[model samples]
Target: MKTYTVNELLKGEQLLQQVKVNGWIRTFRSNRFIALNDGSTLNNIQCVVDFEDTPEDTLKKLNTGAAVCIEGTLVESQGKGQKYEVQVERIEVLGTSDPETYPIQPKKHSLEFLREKAHLRVRTNTFSAVMRVRSALSFAIHQYFRDNGFYYVHTPVITGSDAEGAGEMFRVSTLDAKNPPLTEDGKVDFKEDFFGKETNLTVSGQLEAEAYAMALGKVYTFGPTFRAENSNTSRHLAEFWMIEPEVAFLDLMGNMDLAEDFIKSVIRYVLDHCREDLEFLEQRLLQEEKGKPQNERSEMSLIEKLHFVLDNNFKRVSYTEAIEILKRSKPNKKKKFQYIIEEWGADLQSEHERYLVEKHFNAPVILFDYPAKIKAFYMRMNEDGNTVRAMDILFPGIGEIVGGSQREERLDVLKERVAALGIPEEELWWYLDLRKFGTAVHSGFGLGFERLVLFVTGMTNIRDVIPFPRTPQNAEF
Candidate 1:
């Protein structure tokens, strides 16, 4: 007897061979047909059972979500929609599920309902396909970096530095919460806590990755990063993964090239390897779009959108140029935009970004040379003294998929920017030390992993792409 996965059995032929399979029952129909899935693929294996010979007790336990092992013979399926079927010779119930208690029934469920049942949602077709694509994208990310001479670095999850300087951080404390140590000024003192200083979950790993890039020339960090912003939207997540890559000698132009190439490589990999899953997600998106108004529907299908990105060159436009375009656009002119683009220095919103990608350019766009005041302190200041060499890669549906910049290498300039932002110099002494010692014109970008998955999977909500989404006031498994 041989053990084979449902994927292999479906794609290969071992006619009349005795095989063993372990899986959970997806559905049992007519007291003779069993649909078993083992998490190996999206398709399930139809196992034909001999109801007359099989014990009644065993048959009774073959309900949905019940784990089972079956000794069966591989044979061609008499039914349609699948290639192979298993003729069960012996059946053993590993774990039984009460049909009345199982929440994931064989019917369409809303995304909200499936989210509450996140633990069992993977058993469904949509979630399982999503997760498979997510896994493929993750693997492609690492493979792309590895093949491109980038060393993977694991950055700290807890740090004292506020990388984004937004200050929306979840504090890590070990002292008593009710009555903790207080400074003479009556503020809660963090000196007595672990690490002997204030620390929180990291918002971005770019700062740490910069240090490694300086030492190793090229390095990347792919790990979980936290943001404590109380945002309840389709795009925000309290805890999410980030992919940051830093190169010591790369400039802003080189950074844009790298980001574009990296994105295309990963998408290409997924398109080649995860075709089945992508097709399933594409059809899912098509069916979802049918309910929306004709004007609101997507102009391109999900797979067509993917190919469009791969086939076209990303249009590189300056932030100043984009501002003018948005200002002249009908939406901003008619006050239809939620936040109209009024001036050159005004920050561009997601609406504006989507306009550039989806409407104006009709291709991927990379906007650079943003106003220095709106960008982080690390971005390199251009000669104008008003703008920095920061760039954002905008996709059609997703606004800003990748954000990067050539870092400020001058110690005095960086220190001035840090002081202007009210960030204490002592807190970033180590970061300042990099510029003091051997700083170069390094550039890097941070890509929100969920947003990438959301784009690739054509999933509207960020929560659906990740396994256990951590959002504002919602952390249930």
Candidate 2:
């Protein structure tokens, strides 16, 4: 007997051949047909049983979610929904799921209910399709970087430096929380901590990727990063994976070109390879949008949306220009935006970013040359003494999918900026040393992996894309 996955059997020849198949039952119909899936594909293979030959007790064990092995003859399916199926000659129940206890059944379940049972949510069609597309996108990332002569760099997850200056880091300590060591002023002494210095989970890998990029020429980091902010929004996650690529001898304009090419390549890869999964998700999205008003629904289908980005060039504009447009727009004059744009230096909010990309441009927009005071400390200072070579790529629905800048290459300028931001000069000595030694024109950008997933899979919540989401207070497996 030969073993076969549900997907393999479904694609096999029409001739009757003995095959052994193993999978979990999705649904049992009329006590004769079994819809089984092994996760190789979204489609399930039908297993028709001869009730006359199969024992009554054995038929009762073939409940939904039951694990079973079957020896069957693969032949053309007589069913209307499928082309090929298995005519079982023998069946063995490896595990049985009780109809009363199994959380997953043949019925429509809410996304909230599935989230509560995340451990078993992958067995569902929606979660499984999302995961498959996520995996494909991840592979596409590695392949894209590798094919483009970029090295995959692994940065440390824990560090003493704060890359983003947000100070929303999760402390990694082993000392006693109730009563720890104290200093002379009765303050909690961090000198006695595990690392001999205060350290937390890293917020970004861009700084470290820059260090490697100087030597390697081209480097990218794909790993988990953490933030400790207590945000319960659908888009905010305490822990998420990040993709950062830094290149040597590259300027701000080159950085934008690289980002556009990289994003389009990976998205196109998913479109070509994950067609079945995307098609399933597309239909699921159509069903979901039926509940919403016509104006709120997406105008383009999922496939059309992906192709639109690949075919069109992203609109580029300066931050100063964007500010002027926002100031004169109807939203600002009507006071519709929650954070109205009043001046040039005001930080752009999500609503503003969406309005720029969706309404003003109707395409992906790249806004560069942001105010230095509002951006990070490492960005290169422009000649105007006000703006930095910073850029943010805003998508139609997603506000900010990418953020990056041309790093400060001048040793004195970088030191001054770091000191002015109140960051410890000693903590980032190595980062500064890059400028001192042989730092050239280098630039990099960070893409939130989950947000990219949300864009491609048409998912609204960031929690739904990640397998085990680590949010404000929820860490359940």
Write down the lDDT of every candidate, Cα atoms only: 0.93, 0.93
TM-score per candidate: 0.99, 0.98
Write one digit per residue (lDDT tens) for candidate 1, span 1-477: 778888888875777788899999999999999999998898999999999999898999999999999998898888897788999999999999999999988899999999999999999999999999899999999999999999999999999999988999988879899999999999988889988998899999999999999999999999999999999999999999999999999999999999999999999999999999889999999999999999789999999999989999999999999999999999999998999888889988898999999999999999999999899999999999999999999998889999999999899999989999999999999999999898889999999999999999999999899999999889877
Which digits, one per residue and each the tens of the lDDT, describe model 2 over residues 47-72? 99999999999999999999999888
CA lDDT for candidate 1: 0.93
**What lDDT score is found at residue 443 in candidate 1?**
96
Those runs of model 2 whose alpha carbons end farther than 4 Å from true positions after fitting are none
Candidate 2 worst ten-residue window by lDDT: 6-15
* Candidate 2 vs. true structure, TM-score: 0.98
